[model samples]
Target: MSGTSAGAPEPEGALEPEGAPAPESAPGPRRRRVPRRERERQILDVAVQVFAKRGYHGASVDEIAESAGISKPMVYLYLDSKEGLFLACLRREADRLVGAFQGAATASGASPELRLHAGLLAFFAFVSEHRDSWVVLHRQASELSEAIAAAVAEARRAVMAEVADLVRAGIAEGGPATQLTDEDADFVTHALVGAADSLTDWMARHPDQSPEGVTLRLMNMVWVGMGRVLEGEAWKPVTG
Candidate 1:
């Protein structure tokens, strides 16, 4: 919601009269002064929308400039280029989403089941609310150049680290997850990430489903899956 003046008002006098010397505007729309942090937010917000709609390759700095209602050079001044803008958007959303789940997990004070549910629910909620941002980060960022891929890897590493920490906690609590060794913990962490990523892609394709529905379904799946695994059940592993 916060960004460049939400597009300039109809050039003041342009709408008032075709010929008349239009009355001066009331010092113009309140220039919402975007400070450094807020300016970066605004840029990322615009970038998410543009990249989500057009994808990384299809999107242009010129289009992002137009969409953000800023000069092309200004977009460059803030984000450097298309790749920079896209990565900024990815980093911002990934950081927020990861932090949200981490906080939710620690603060829930519920059993591991409830904490896990709350964390996954929060994750889906973020993706639901910030669909554009989610898309840019989850989709476009993956296909970017090597430099951008490195940025994506860093963000992903942070998220995976949090997941691993939670997994360790779950194991310490002696739940079904407790059987996981360090290697198993890493595998489970990556599996959770892969599951969430797949769910995001699925929900994106099926916008008709409510966020609550998607969240609940994933919660049930994870809960049931972990419960089954804890019961000493195992599925066949793929062999090369």
Candidate 2:
């Protein structure tokens, strides 16, 4: 008598009829919305991994999107095209590399030489820790088109300028021999960057070598020589 009748009003949010297909099971949980910028970054992160693993021509928007758990069209929507995605990876990695160098080199209170050493150490550390990023930035050069080349060049120039400034500062301080020009500084920058670029490969071959050791060796070889050059000693190339 006290129990509700069969036709009594059903409570709100009650279960569906026993055999009536379970009313679609309440939609599990809503997927939290990712903001556009965050979504783009997530897409880019997956893109970098794929691009690193597969060169530009080989990498596909489909795989990158799937890896990112998104649709291919969504990748295009976020990055425009595969080329755009590669460019984005290049720029982001380059910015990160540049930021690492600048942040280390500009560190307060250390001597100029130490700051420069710190910067080089930071470079090696970054390359070591971010092998995929380095691969994307370094190895992807072979796939360059106009925009890709330009993005790569821009990153190179930014790093060169930072090193050149340090070189110029060193030249200014070294007594009476502070005659280094911007051109001279750039020449040094090219050599240093080139060597560092090559060393990334060497680093891959020698995983046991620590970044600090690598940095020290490079500084002893290059930075010491750099100081001598800045002081106008001029270690000219050997001629037979």
Clashing pairs in 2: none
Query: What number of backbone clashes does candidate 2 have, counting pairs of residues 3 or more apart or in separate chains?
Result: 0
Candidate 1 per-residue lDDT over residues 102-124, each given as its tens digit: 88877888576667767777888
Report RMSD (Å) for each prediction in the order shown. 8.5, 13.8
Whole-model lDDT, candidate 2? 0.76
lDDT of 2 by residue, 56-105 (tens): 88988888877887667666655666777777778788889999999999
Residue 97 miss distance in model 2 (angstroms) = 0.9
Per-prediction TM-score to the true structure, in the order listed: 0.75, 0.82
